[model samples]
Target: MPQNIVVSQPEDLTVAWAQRVVKLHEPHTLVTQVDLVSVEVGTTTRIRLAVTYHAETALPRRWFVKLPSLAWRARFITALPQLLETEIRFYQELAKAVPIALPVCLAAQSRWGLGSILVLADIEEHGALPGEPHDVLSAAQAGLVVDGLARFHARFWHQHGTVPRYRWLAGRVRQVEDHLGTVLAVPLMQQGLRRSGAAVPVGLHQAALHYARNRRRAMRFLSALPQTLVHHDCHPGNLFWQQHQAGLLDWQLVRIGEGVSDVAYFLATALEPEQRRLCETGLLARYAQQLHSHGITDVDSGQLNGRYRAHLVYAFEAMVVTLAVGDMMPTASNLELIRRTATAVEDLDAFAALPI
Candidate 1:
């Protein structure tokens, strides 16, 4: 494949380039015209392409292309090579092995200074829809997501030490610790805190402030727990759903950590307060049952409950830091995530449960 075929902009997606990429999946098809259906820019750029194939050729009408964002903020944030590398590697190496539903990567590539590009099958064409950050998940939707997560975590559970192939997935906690100072200093942090302050309990807010000072110690404690492959960024915006089926997107933050982090983060950030309060215990129980069915018998409800609480602090800090440094445009969603996560922390007494 020619390197020039990899593009950073929609204009660069010529018909020839489109054909080359589509041919990787459909050899006999010829794309006549490539229309730019939609463009969504964030930490990454998502371009939807509507292709007109030659008559009698069998090819999908639409495909989704993911490339590094051209926006100054997005490019600056994703400039960290590992951030793009992780997602590219996930699609290239691990996406097939995982049992959970995720987008099918038709093609993907990552270059150090140049941006990354991922061509994926359009799940939207098949009834899957990306989740909105501000929208809350109902009980049924949350259950589907939890079930998918259980399968994903169980597949890679306890494999970190034994599998050399997974060595790349470690060090997520350390990475967060290293970047905490810069993240805290971003101007959006104060604004986000202020916007959501009323909904955040005093104890939880105090814990967040204190946790900032001792983040290293807190991360160290969590890292010492049993490890498994986690979709470290499992909040609402990174998820997709269709009826009973839930699909996860954005593999950039995938890492080795306590699997319950995904559970805690997803439930706390994605569900409304009353809905979360009603469904949380039952969901946790359901997850435990799924884990057991998948042959992970060492963890019981008590251990999961404790770890889940501790992880609520981790999830809260992560959301705050991410909102602090990343796209501050979604202020409402950022505030909701912070407020809901803080509520979970208070409800669970997560700060007290932390080893620090």
Candidate 2:
């Protein structure tokens, strides 16, 4: 394949293209074969590849590649916002500066009409375990993730505009996405709640409906806080575990936002309600302390708690919206997340925290 050639699906990853990508990292190596080990399609198509080299090298045998979704609905949802493109940009431009573990980018490229390709070192090859959406985290595991996110948030704390290079983190694409989300909020939320059946408690339906009706205002309220780089979709499935350390994945929703939003989303989606109730306060304190250790000292525990409670609304909405969209995640996972987030919202009175 030529330098200009960009693959759009697992089948397009020809040996020639594989060689071309490999040669960039290992000058002496030539790819002899390319085998598609497995492929999973959701909002994006994740392809696991096995590459054989002509000569001995230290390069990984397996590689992970992400492409735009093959599912039409998922593709349509992500296309306008250029979610995969944004993630490609993250790998190309900012992955190295991140504090926690992330897959090593081997090659990343995007073209407006040609689509995008992200080649990464398969973390499984490095003995890391990928987190599944249905896996509930123990309090100890959730605490580790909270710590990792704190370090990440602290490094980029309040640096949104000051860092000219990262100004795009809060750029127009996010604004447009937020606008579209608000526009679709009511129908999607209603549909999701209906689809949720008995998963969401009856008591929370009116509050959820009201929040959906006033989503634009709710969005504004959520953003009216100190901003930092956040993994806006911080559920368990988007994480990987290695030696008890949590590494983040799925940068498609990475953007500038209140850092506590990540904490709220993670806890709501990642933990069992009982476990979350037991450990969230301590984990939150640990997050603040981690931020302080990283020289971010202005965060107040009381205010942080309020922000966290408020942010749980988005977490609930996100899962509901995912369910509404369909095909974006497993129905079972989506329902469970909706259940957990709904419970969190009611438990914390998350909607009350919103200005609306």
Best by lDDT: 2
* TM-score of decoy 1: 0.90
Enumerate residue pairs that collide in model 1: none
lDDT of 2 by residue, 1-356 (tens): 33754687789898888888877877778889989999988999999999898878888989999999998988988888889988988888888889999998888888768889888999999899999887899888888999999999998998987989898878888887888888889999999889999889999899999999999888888899857899899998999999989999999889888999999999999999998898889999999999999999999999999999999999999998888888899999889998899889988999999988
| Candidate 1 residue spans exceeding 4 A from truth | 1-4, 56-58, 171-191, 195-203, 326-329
lDDT of 1 at 310: 88
- 310 Cα displacement, candidate 2 (Å): 0.4
Most accurate candidate by TM-score: 2
The 10 consecutive residues of candidate 2 with the worst lDDT sum are: 1-10
Residues 189-306, candidate 1: write the lDDT tens digits. 4544555657566555556666666766777787677568898888888888776688888888788888888999999999987889999999999999988889888887998888
Q: For all candidates, what are the clash counts?
A: 0, 0
Score candidate 2 by lDDT: 0.90
